[model samples]
Target: MTKIPTALLLTCDAQLVEIDLPFGHDCASSAERRAVLRAALRCDRFDVVALTRQWDMWIDDEGLYNHPVNPAATALAQRFGFTHQPYHGPVLLTGGPDAQGNTLPLLRHQVIGLFLTLQDL
Candidate 1:
């Protein structure tokens, strides 16, 4: 048995909100991911969103960070056009093109990390 890569969603104050370790072909859609963020922003319990897999961390930094957007995430952001400013931040999407031109997202057991800052909202 292999371990699934863990993804942690942390608030600006560094509170853990969600931890996702998706299973085979069960990656969350862009919309679903956005919804989680939206709900968090609305709660006011969190101001910053930080998603990390292992050592890779994506921080919106109150919309200050210019983190490179993931190609597949960019497409989903374009499609939804969420009004929230942080939604303009990078998202988590599946089926990204690989180096060999294979349309695969991350490894099945790999986690997708996404981040947004509610201060921009």
Candidate 2:
């Protein structure tokens, strides 16, 4: 079967994870969640394209540095190893199939951003 990369929505609570990570469950504590986050980010089993909101508010594409990035988000990105932002922002998160029909990395970092997006959503 063709695998569609799953996006791990990073959040501080439980919203709707069954839609993506069926094998996962609600975390009991912040420490537990962080542990899971670290493992997911560094898992060698597959690539994880991290995602998160860098800025508190939307900004122009060129204005990435013009505004202050969320310190928490920045720390999370750095903690996960996202050398730079990869997904489009200002309200745009697009995706498509891989050439090999292989699923993309379950978004662990953007999954980081993703976790937030799902939280906000």
Candidate 3:
């Protein structure tokens, strides 16, 4: 059996929820993927948000790093005309892109690893 990565957990509208996904015999449809992204993003407030793996305070200290906004994030931003900004600092949450075009939940260590990879200098 193939071990699928865990789904990303998101707090939407104050509701902590996981992306709607199928398991075993079922696969998550594109509609489900859209719904998950729609709910996860806040266009009004987060039209353009920044993310980071680390902070150097001074720009010269280290080169800037940022996450590449994927299609999912871009679509959401476009729908609401929200700005899409990439960033690199510390991840307060645990998530990343999965094969299904949805964020997958990660452990603290996993998140740290991702951050390290993103901001590696």
Best by TM-score: 1
Q: Which wins on TM-score, candidate 1 or candidate 2?
A: 1
- Cα lDDT tens digits for candidate 2, 1-121: 5444343332222222322322223445434533443343322122223233231211124424333333333444445565466322122121222454322334434345555654453
Worst 10 contiguous positions by lDDT, candidate 1: 44-53
Best model number under lDDT: 1
- State the C-alpha lDDT per candidate: 0.35, 0.34, 0.32
Q: Over the stretch 51-100, how does candidate 3's per-residue lDDT look in tens digits?
A: 32221110111112222224332332243344553222211233444455
Ranking by lDDT: 1, 2, 3
Q: In terms of TM-score, which candidate is stronger, 2 or 3?
A: 3
Listed in order, each prediction's TM-score against the native is 0.27, 0.24, 0.26
> Which digits, one per residue and each the tens of the lDDT, describe model 1 over residues 1-121?
7543234444443344443423333346544544454443333122322222212233343433433333332333343453244332333232333454322334443333332322122
- Candidate with better TM-score, 1 vs 3: 1
How well does candidate 3 score on lDDT at residue 36? 41
Worst 10-residue stretch by lDDT in candidate 3? Answer: 54-63
Question: Between which residue pairs do clashes occur in model 2?
Answer: 9-115, 10-115, 50-109, 50-110, 51-109, 51-110, 51-111, 51-113, 52-113, 109-112
